[model samples]
Target chain A: MDILGDLLLGVQTAFSFWNLTYCLLGVFLGTAIGVLPGLGPTATVAMLLPVTFGLSPETAIIMLAGIFYGAQYGGSTTAILVNLPGESSSVVTAIDGYQMARQGQAGKALATAAIGSFIAGSIATVLIAFFAPLLSSVALAFGPHEYFALMVLGLAASVVLASGSLLHAVGMILFGLILGLIGTDVQTGAMRFTFGSFELADGISFVVVAMGVFGLGEILSNLENESDRTTVLTKVTGLMPTRADLRAMLAPVGRGTALGSVLGILPGGGAMLSSFASYALEKKVSKNPQQFGKGALAGVAGPEAANNAGAQTSFIPMLTLGIPSNPVMALMIGALIMQGIQPGPSVVQDQPVLFWGLIVSMWIGNLMLLVLNLPLIGIWVKMISIPYGYLFPCIVAFCLIGVFSLANSTFDIWLMGLFGVAGYILRKLDCEPAPLLLGFVLGPMLEEHLRRAMLVSRGDVTSFVTSPISAVLLLVAAALIASVLAPAIRSKREEAFQDED
Target chain B: MQGHRTKDFWAGAIYLVLGLATVILARDLTLGSAARMGPGYFPTVLGGLLAIIGLVSLLRGLLRPGELVERIHMKPMILVIGATLFFAIALDFLGLAVALPAAMFITATASKRFRLAPVPLLGLVAFTIFCVLVFVRGLDVPLPMFGTLFGG
Candidate 1:
């Protein structure tokens, strides 16, 4: 399908009043939460997931996607004004952004971030519109063998890139897979591990697990620390970037957008790593690297651009292949599942309006964020002071009500509580929850494909290796694991030599 | 601070038990041939893989030292999780209005900045009302204001 045709369909769905209103509401609320410390797009989305249950799938997703746009943009707001990043991707933005604030150029920095993000988002959205259909067609050609191999590669890649020890990350993935296999077998309709209860027959809802882990668990962890809740940013003197500032940012935005768009399509790469990579690239290629931590326009513009671009392109894999590249994408997949739409290549074929509309809304959401956040910076800044004392309790209340609304069984609330404790325990052990979520989302699918592929080959275990695409995918999965282990083995050898000496 | 090895050992032990449990549970299900696999075949393999992973992790925990485990905060762990459990159990008996506030109040009290001030008290009450109006009345979540336990 031509890019123009798809986007035209998207515009038709996106421009509807209800869809437009929800898109605006999503970005607006997303930005609102993103500006607040310790409450990010993930937590906000997880907590507010129940609100989408009543809406159509297309409308529900537009609002959620809007939140992401708002949050990404809002992350820069806190980074510039308060010297603290509201999200991890904005950590690099905070380095020079906070310096600009200190030097009384906060307005210039904020404007650069907003404009750079808008430019990058516009470019990446176009890229997605063009590429998604092509990718979906390719995905449609994949057999169960290739799909299974791809999932294995994806899971392994996530563990290698996770923010924790290899053992812990692996452990989390294994644990999540175990959790995913808790229900009845799809083939035989035989209850696999349901034990006795009817609730166990269908397995646990991803909603309960997500809200419990990200939302409730976060509340538990945040409540442990005593916060001062004082607003650090005193005042803003200016609100626009000069011509010179815009000129300096042009290259970084271009480079960062290119870098992020490519990286975001890779397995286990998304906004957080893209932003960091862009910042490092800017520093290395800068004419005056010494000016890096001292309020360089490229420093603010590059990462902000990269993060937004990465966030936009990360949707490609989830939209076409039904694979989540990160935790946020995992949540999006969960959202799609809840809307009763199976996530895969057929999403475009089955629900063209919903699929294209979401793509269009993402672009429109970015535009809305640019227009909404810039004029309303003063109001967003004040939101940073919203105390944790109030926030945590409110989150707790929502989690309870939200989980309760799912099937109207109070039992889900109890299940969420159980996972709340489990999530916190995993966090304490330094096990990243992102990979666990990915594993959970992929586990059942992985099993089905593995079995089907074997069944198709008539008991020939070597059939997976014989298929070219599946073989290549398996090799990639093996390579990822080998790369991770190579470093550890080398370190151990060096340690042994040092001990002998 | 005991190193994370202690925690790793515990984590591995849990993984080991879960893997073994899965293996045991699925033992009865037919593990059909590769061409026509039964329901137990995939999970049994996964269960075995998990068991091996747990064993390797356990060995690594013994060999390599790691970061210190974070100190657990009991107050919030008990109050927050407990409050959620309390709400779940109480919701059917006491209804949404009472059960919701009870959970929120417990969680709010667990906060370091929380005090018995009117602002916080009022805020909690107001949030509950908002949720009730939105979820119960607007969304029609079927949560009663009072429950069978209250004879309402």
Candidate 2:
């Protein structure tokens, strides 16, 4: 009964004229940008973050959340039509979807993706409405020790999941933590690494780092070895799937949604990981596993559903625990902080409108994607043909302007450029920046919790393990690290990500 | 050049230098005790861990036949970074009108497909106007169309 009342309140807020308009605008822009090659949801969100500064907090978050999941929908379009995955999360979709396209089943593949995503998103939205409040209630009991242990688990899991050298990932995490230390110390009023600059006192804005690393850094890499993209565009006919095709997709969609919703709640698990895991699971479970890479209907359905579900449910950790499972969630936290809201369990209790509004908007956004994307498939196909020559400049221009508008200062722009160069170099060294971004966002909070926990226990380190919840979290973190270090699991992890390369 | 010129080696070296730098810099900030940590304790510990990780990575790079670093492409990397820096410097003095187009032009040059032609120039000009309308007029970002140097 209470949930029904809350759901009614959410409907009232989300159905408001302006909120609907912003939600539509967000998904439309998200899809348009997502349809482009070489741009992921993280970069898209980062570039567009400055645009949302002018809107109300509820409307702003609604739009950003729309962009986050809408990109998942758009990515599958490019993957199916042109064999070019527009986002990393859609890489597995390109395998079978592109095969289907080449076999004159482009429309069917697109339809399947849309249908699967809609169903998965709807289910995940409901799951979030039920589970997020429950999770927050548990999180409400967390002390500094437990919180610190939770962050450590999050960081360790991120390192384990990062698709590169474990040592480099750890190094990057430490590097991010150091970068986070460049602001004024909250307790002592001591400026640690400001180098006597007033701008450094507030610290490096995550927006600047995000734009520099994900946006500009991505552009530099795209420009490298600039070969012309040759798209063998497929003709799309029969915009609806057959009854048999629908029947085949149902089981995989259900399984993928179930797996993705669970994984997406875990720290460091989101769209990309969920899709990959779904593909692997589908391959193992299917009776005709050989059909996987050769246009099996389940292949397109499974990963597409999983990715969409994961994208939606990944909001849980960020919304409930104030811990970001991925970089996009990190940006969301940054957005919430900018809106003068501290993200935590209290968000559910104190800002019920925002909490429920965002959850309901996600389902509405998913419905919009299903309705809008099917007819707009042709335009998305055309968007992929936009030359890299023109696109990178616009991105660079946006990055320049967006970073500048953050504080109307050139210092942030300069910092972005520096990080862009660093990001490029790190990429060349096979170091993934995702973990670093997560660490940068978590670093200050991690340190604060650690200090407070120690202070509470009179400097005794055993307090971290003595607390039952904290002990379990620490044990899980230790196990995650140990699993990554184990030679057999390390190789298996590489095998899982091999398809990405 | 003589031994393993692997990516891990350079990455480790960079990390090693950065970690040491963090430790050295944090020395001035009082570390205090674990109970009441000063500003320095966290960074110092993190920096030390980073240094140790870097050392292991460096040794691993030398011992193992790992993936080599790819050849650095200087042109795009330099031009893109250079154009960004130019925009930052120019936005204050030359403003968005002058800075954005110039930066766009330079960024376009980084692409191999770019040419000294009219159509792309026209497109850049059109884009600049659109940005002015959206970011400045519509969103009311506090950027001048022309800079203080223009006496606006």
Question: Which candidate has the highest lDDT of all?
Answer: 2
- Cα lDDT tens digits, model 2, A1-501, are 289888988898899999999999889877877778777778778888888888888899999999889999998988888788878889999999999988888889999999999999999999999999999999999999999999999899888887878899899999998998789999899998899999999999999999999998888888875656655663467888789989999999999999889888776778888999999999999999999899999999999999999998999999999999989999999999998899988898888889988888888999899987887677777777888798889988988888888998899988999999999989988888988899899999999999999999999999998999999999999999999888999889999888889
Candidate DockQ values, in order, are 0.72, 0.87
TM-score of 1: 0.95
Which residue runs does candidate 2 get wrong by more than 4 Å? B1-4
For each candidate, what TM-score against the reference? 0.95, 0.98
| Candidate 1, residue A458: how far the Cα is off, in Å | 1.2
Task: Write candidate 1's Cα lDDT for A233-284 as tens digits.
Answer: 6566577777887889999999999988987876567787788789888999
Docking class of 2: high
Worst 10 residues of 2 chain A by lDDT: A226-235
lDDT at residue A391 of model 1 (Cα atoms): 79
Backbone collisions counted per model? 0, 0
